[model samples]
Target: MTWLVTGGAGYIGAHVVRALAAAGIDPVVIDDLSSGHASFVPEGVPFVEGTILDQALVEDTLRTHGVEGVIHVAGFKYAGVSVQRPLHTYEQNVEGTRVVLAAMAAAGVTNIVFSSSAAVYGTPDVPLVTEDLPKRPASPYGESKLIGEWMLRDQGVATAGSSQPLRHTSLRYFNVVGSSDTSIYDSSPHNLFPLVFEALLAGNTPKIFGDDYDTPDGTNVRDYVHVGDIAAAHVVAAQRLAAGEQVEPAYNLGSQNGLSVREIMDAMARVTGIAFEPEISPRRPGDPDRIVATGELAARDLDWANRFSVDDMVRSGWEARRAAG
Candidate 1:
């Protein structure tokens, strides 16, 4: 009943830990605090301070906690930065996943819920991305996430005949926003929500990267899902794996709808009562015109849905960020 949540001190992983705990499952944490806050780990949850890249530490933690499964969420997540620091991304994501699998094999753990990314699809020309889309990762971060999924697949195949075959699933999505808990806010400097919040809090207008994309608002369109919804899906995925139920290799935790940067800016102004036009700048390279996915598979299997509206997402995240100050 005990599960290990890697990077449980981080924004997304911390929400997953809380979700698992609320579901009557014991959750253990192993976070290096590289991009995570120590205070984000709940007071009662058992936490080990270490990196997943360290096989010895990971194995020891798993054995000590009697962890039945692992929710692998630790990694370098900045897509833009990953292009500059590909080595670090691969080491933390690609090689790190391999090490986790090796440790799982050594520790006899047979289940995993991988935190994958929608970036694996690159710039999809389709209206809504599906699970079967051909992967064309545009950045090292995306490439690493795809590789991590592959490792899980190959390991599952290799262990199919064993006493404890691997039960795994990867959940992919873009633009995870909002906060499930006021105490565990998103602290990622690269995320859109936090960046706008930071600018508004500083009495500065937020800048949109570009407003010339082929969309209704001329801003790039992307999927945005609340963090609570994202965390709830992970809990369901873990439970399904634990129950020996049928599961897909990957699922997109996406909102069928897409939102533009201008829409988000409007939401921010409305929610925060900060009425200021967003400054528009030239588009950053590799910025895709549109990328959204269909969460039909996740909706059917993991009971996934976008429970929070754009205003709700903005208010909650803004409140949490302001509370952290």
Candidate 2:
């Protein structure tokens, strides 16, 4: 069966596209290139250059490609930036998802795997977050993701009695790092891995935003999962949806184990052989003490697991970035 992957040329989306191809499923790509690279798309995969916000373009792509399902990965993903650009975030993430669902309904596409975020939970007081935790989004980006999930849920309800009822699942991701393909490195200017790599590549010290959080090492602890594992879960989710297997409305794709900024810095040094200490900057506004989740639900259903260690994660991302340079 064929599946359409929105934002398929992006770092994570590109990895998902490759995974789908490896699994013997035909894949089609639709990306606006706002934060993605066309060169990252593998040769021979059908690609359409456009935004998901365009309902006509999305519906046409789905019908033209004979797509049976859609893996929606396109969105405004920067949480901090979303705070400053709330309107843009809402437009890209919220309105964009609405349009995708509408287009799916129009094209009689019955399945979709949405790309959600951990930011939807905001800063919970608990040590390990689960799927049932209260969603208190702290930023416009987070809020937009939450609204996107709601749209999927409501759409499913609205179409429950239709001949082609919607089947959907939202995978909530934590800190996604590393690289599955050396050709497709994380290029986000806001992500941690690229920030550290760029600083070291420029012969400068990396800076930790905060090192005094109430964690084991007085630094912010986060679940850093490899991008390959993240992509693999998407592939499995697509398969389950295509087969009409039951899936939860949402699944937390987390590592369960949390790593501190200091710990990440240490791994960066060990992997890249850059032996410079990271500067400890004051915490940014609205920074949380910690945010990590358990992937038990995904592990049970999507074959999810954090297979890569901290060192491996750093090494893969570092190597990919260096290779690009």
Candidate 3:
């Protein structure tokens, strides 16, 4: 009856575990502690430290834990860096997913809630990206994620006649920020909130990648959802899948009402009381001017929404960052 959460010691995965715990559901964790902290796994929660690439270990963990479902969140998740390390990214995200799926099949665990990304849209033209948008992943990381979704879909097709055809859903999100748990902080060098917080904490000027983009502000505009909300949606999806209820193949957990980079800087100044302006830097290659998705479908199903405002998002991450310091 327990749910196995892969990468449950990582920031977002830890939040998902907390959400599942709050729902009175038992969560067993399988984390390799690659970028995750062992301490983040809740005290007394069943934890097995191993990579998803180990199919035997994954299968054993599922069988040993009597897991009814899995929330797969373990993978290499740096889109920008993936361009430079395509092979590593593919091995971790694609191959790791393959191993997890194989283990699930072997263990007869037929339900899974995948931790997906909006990077699959890859410079989408639509102002409001949706579940129906054609996936055109730009980087290897995004490509790997799309392939993971395909794996789930094809598996569902292949096992349709089985007693337990895999019931699964992938939640695609962009720019997850803020923190509900001060103990679990975002340490990703590639993420915006941590990058800015680190720069300010070091008494260095935070630099904006570009300020010449064609947006309301001079910088890019994208959906920045709170981590807590993201975790909540995952729990909801898992519950639905485990209940054998029909769910969409994929859902995008994003904000129709997103913020611009400049607007975020303004919030940072207000929240952290840091008055210095961010340094302007050259645009990173393949940087889009704006990329925000509408979560109407997720809202209908997963209780998704932008419950936290820009100020709330900024303050939450700032508080966690300061606490970590």
Candidate 4:
């Protein structure tokens, strides 16, 4: 059965598409091209360029492609930008997900793998967060995602008695970095990896937003997982759902290891052989001091393993960025 991958032409979405292709499954793509690149989509896979907000378009694509499952990844994803454009974030993330679910119910598609975020956990006092942690999003973007999850949960409950009920697995990710290929490396200016890479390419020092965090290095710490590994988890989730196995509404995907901002910078310097210092500033509002995940559930359930280290993530991103130049 074919799968529908929203935002399939984007960085993480493109990697998921590639993983699906590698598994000998040809998934169809629907993207509005607002943030995704057309070139990133693999050849021979059917692609429909449009917004998820367009319910008719989404339903038509699903029906035309005979899609049995969906991997939803289309949405606005910048945490800092979401603080400024709360309305836009809600519309794209929450409302857009609602539209997709409505279309899925209309088209009789039952299985889905949602791309959620660790931001839903907000700034918990605990260092390593688990799937069961309390969700208290600090930003509009995070709240939007939590709302999307609620939509799925509520919808699932409403359709429980239906012959074909919607079965979904929402994967909450923390700092998805690196690239599946050079053509689809992150184009967003907001993410740390891309921002630093762009600054270094322009012969400028990358700026660190905060240096007074309680972390050991006096910088923010995050769980940086490889994009390829994230893609693999989606694949496994899709397969499990299709196999008629019982699945939960959400799971956390992360490295289970925290990497400090300074550590990332040092790794980049080591990989690219460039010696440059980052300009430190006060911590941005809504920014968490540390956000790491306990990915044990994903590892046990999906057989997911992060093969790339911090150095590998940096070097792969460097290669992809240089190739894009």
Candidate 5:
């Protein structure tokens, strides 16, 4: 009853892998080492160095390892960069999901936990978004993720008549930050935390894009959830699917309360005891003013609760970044 964790060497993926291992479940991993670190993967787990687009490799890994479930987390996730390279984003996120689904169908692995994003909800009229909100993705990355969720839903329907029907759960997360351990600090230069950390390390002020939004602090507000909580939700989602729980295809993993950019910086300063300055800049395209999730559905269905506060998230990220240095 092994699980196949795509991009298991990545920041959040590594945390999921660690969570699975801590629960005494040794899942097989397939990561290309594109933006993931090889050291992030634990020693005993069997790791395959490849991409999810490699259908043959994915099928082989699934079949050989007796993988009953899959947690897909391999994809490009930079909003600004996605706008510049829409085609690359589509290929990696949308087309890559197609390959993984095809392989799962071939290997008879029906259970899946998709890593979706809250970016799919672009500039919602409501303050706290629900699962039923209209998906109006602003960037190519968000569009690709929405398409990926559609793919899973379609696949699940197509396999319904089979003896072992496909069961899928897509967790739409918002602003996934922080670290579960110091060993797997974020390596991507695109995410906000790592970018700010790098800037501060270089003795420069972290830049804040858009200081005049409609929010209270005149900055964008986001629901920042800890990586460990997100990883725990994945585990619970997998268990529910495996237990034959008749649930929807997707759930939102987010903090019910939102945090503004200024709040985040304040938390960072408080956690690290460093007075950091921020350079104000104009808003980047495709960034919504406020995007937070209710996460009530996930709590009711998957029993997912975010235990780490915003301060905890910032402190853990600071600790991990400091250790990495």
Candidate 6:
């Protein structure tokens, strides 16, 4: 059973495709290359260049690839930037999800693994957020992701009691850093790992936003999971759905023990051998002091594990970036 991965050329999507291949599952890629690179798609894999907004293209990809399931990852992912581009975010995330579901229904693809976000729980006052938190999304991106989850829920309800009911799950995670393969790395300008690495490479010190936060080291703390672990969990979820095992509507892939910006900077310095203190900048509006969810549920079902340390994340990310050239 081949799985179609939308946005398979992007960093996280590319990693998912690789993990699927490694697990001996066949994967076909469809990427629009809006924020992804063509080179990131593994050689010999079927690559279809198209947007998830194109219902026809998505349906064709599913049919042509003999796909039984989908791992949807395509979206406008930058939360900070999403505030300035709310319309674009909704179009890409909410409308794009609707299009994908429509195509899936048309193609009779009953199973899907959605690449959801931690943004859905923006600025939660609670410590160690659980899967059942009150979703007070602060940005359009988060709201769109929540709306996407709602679409999946409504579809599942609409298709219930069928011979093959829609089996779907969404994974929400924070700070997805590190790389499983050095050939493909995070390139999002909004991500911390890439932004810091790029600044260092350009002979500029990386800046840490908001050092006055009421946390350890006076910086924001977040759950920074390894890309490999994240990909593995996605594959596990897909396998569970294929086996007809019941799954949650949403699962948080996070770390109970999170990392801080200062810790990340220290690791980057040690890994890259570029010892320079990061400049502290004012907090971005709507940025929370700390946001880390509990991965107890994922660890139980999806085999979620934080196998990489902060140093591991920094080293792998740095190696991939320097090697990309």
Point to the candidate with the largest lDDT: 1
lDDT of 6: 0.92
Quick one: ranking by lDDT, best first?
1, 2, 6, 3, 4, 5
Inter-residue clash pairs, candidate 5: none
Local accuracy by lDDT, each model: 0.94, 0.94, 0.92, 0.90, 0.88, 0.92
lDDT, candidate 3, 1-325, per-residue tens: 5999999999899999999999988999999999999988989899999999999999999999899999999999999899999999999999999999999999999999999999999999878898899899999999999999999999999999998798999999999999998888898988999999998888999888999998877899999999999999999999888777879999999899778999988898889998978899999988888899999989999998788988999898888878876
For model 5, give the 10-residue run with minimal summed lDDT: 19-28
Clashing pairs in 6: none
Q: Model 5 reaches what TM-score against the true structure? A: 0.96
- List residue ranges in candidate 2 displaced over 4 A: none
How high is the lDDT of residue 259 in model 5?
93
lDDT of 4 by residue, 1-325 (tens): 7899999989999999999988877799999999999998988989999999999999999999889899999999998899999999999999999999999999999988999999898888888898898999989999999999999898888888989888988999888888768777988878889999988888999878899888898998999999989999999999998888877688888777889999999998899999998888777876778888988888888877889989999988888888987
Off by over 4 Å in 6: none
Model 1 misplaced stretches (Cα beyond 4 Å): none
lDDT of 1 by residue, 102-219 (tens): 9999999999999999999988889899999999999999999999999999999999999989999999999999998898788888999999999998999899999988899899
lDDT, candidate 2, 1-325, per-residue tens: 9999999999999999999999999999999999999999999999999999899999999999899999999999999899899999999999999999999999999999999999999999998999999999999999999999999999999999989999999999878999988999999999999999999999998998887788899889998999999999999999999998999999999889889999999999998887998898889877778888999999999999989999999999988898897
Poorly placed runs, candidate 3 (over 4 Å): none
Winner on TM-score (4 vs 6)? 6
TM-score of every prediction relative to native: 0.99, 0.98, 0.98, 0.97, 0.96, 0.98
lDDT of 4 at 28: 93
Model 3 poorest ten-residue lDDT run: 316-325
What is candidate 5's lDDT per residue for 1-325, written digit by digit as tens? 6899999989999999988877666788999998898899999899999988899999999999999899999999887799999999998999999999999989989899999998888778888899999999888988999999999999888888988688998999877899989887987787788888888788888889989999999999989899999998888888888888877778888788889999998887777777977789989876778888988989988778889887899889888989987
Angstrom error at residue 4, model 2: 0.4
